[model samples]
Target: MRSSPRLFQYACRITLFTRQNCSLCVNAKQVLSTVWDKHPFVYKEIDVMTPDAKGWQDLYEFDVPVIHIAKTEHGLERPELSAKAQKLMHRFSAEQVMEKMDIISDPKS
Candidate 1:
């Protein structure tokens, strides 16, 4: 996968499922903010406790700070893209997230 570095993280939308009082969620937001500052993307936050959270509350109530990275509408659920392609959960860094994004963008690399 020979392409621009910017191409990897671009066009990716991140859906962050969180709870109101989760400290891990707070930290995850901070890390994601750092990544956004460098390379902006479509970032959406869904509070599991919110009434309008759709189905996120039931899916991730016990798993605060769960992050789903996708290039298109809710694709790439499999973690087999590599270790880097696994769904980010609990504790993660900007680098880990970026690596996953890169693999997602160019899986043949």
Candidate 2:
């Protein structure tokens, strides 16, 4: 799991579930990189193909390039995040991610 140290635990955490040699995963990664550079959130990339990543692989075996945006200021995920923490599947765009990020940063949204 790779991340940016600058982003504290309280910040929004973006988790990207991906695998090797997948065109969609590569494309997702590129888009995520663009979003990350623009927003500078706590980003993490997990390769589902890894031996220890079996958990994620099991859930997303057929669905690669899954993204989860979690906002946990206390390091505890709130299931009530209607928009704060959202899962993005398949192909997505930076604009879509930015929208989600906006909601995460603004609780009133």
Count backbone overlaps in model 2.
0
lDDT of 2 by residue, 26-59 (tens): 8988998898788877777888789977767777
**lDDT scores for all predictions?**
0.74, 0.75
Q: C-alpha displacement of 31 in model 2, angstroms?
A: 0.9
Weakest 10 consecutive residues of candidate 1 by summed lDDT:
77-86
What TM-score does structure 1 among the candidates reach?
A: 0.73
Tens-place lDDT digits, model 1, residues 1-109: 5767656444677878788889999999999999888766678777878887646676778978988876644454432432343369999999988877666566454
**How does each model score on TM-score?**
0.73, 0.74
- lDDT of candidate model 2 versus the reference: 0.75
Which regions of candidate 1 fall more than 4 Å away from where they truly are? 1-10, 72-86, 107-109
